[model samples]
Target: MPQPAGFAFLERDGVVVITHHGRTATTLRGARAADFLEDVEDGDAQEIMARLTGNYRRGNERQARNHPRNKGR
Candidate 1:
């Protein structure tokens, strides 16, 4: 089966970005990366990526509700 292209791991300022085919698909903070990666490494790359970013998505949604533009909506 085909698979995702190699991912690039980059840190600019403090965030670590994971990209495939040169497109950023997700990010994790440098501090959380080690333990988070260790916990998810056994899964397929796509699944592992989804697990990593899934929490980010949920967190973003929760945070968006608090954003000034979204507040009281």
Candidate 2:
């Protein structure tokens, strides 16, 4: 799978942070991903942000803009 365009990270000490252009492909999904990896899904925004510290969201405009023509939105 391709990268999600953006993501977030928590330092060893637990400081939530975000990345506009992510370095890795394929975001780590699920609670662990949201909790530990710091990446939050857009749909899950309210739920995730409420529990977590901040937004580690990525790939919003990029996904909308770069969607594969063959995929058929």
Tens digits of per-residue lDDT, candidate 1, 1-73, equal 4654455566666666777657676878767766555654665656566556553332377778888998779
Best by TM-score: 1
TM-score of each: 0.39, 0.22
Every candidate's lDDT: 0.63, 0.43
Clashing pairs in 1: none
> Model 2: clashing residue pairs?
none
> lDDT tens string, model 2, 1-73?
4423334443443444433344322333445554644435435443443344344334496676677873655
**Worst 10-residue stretch by lDDT in candidate 1?**
50-59
| RMSD, candidate 1, Å | 8.1
Judge candidate 2 against the unseen true structure and give its global Cα lDDT, from 0 to 1: 0.43
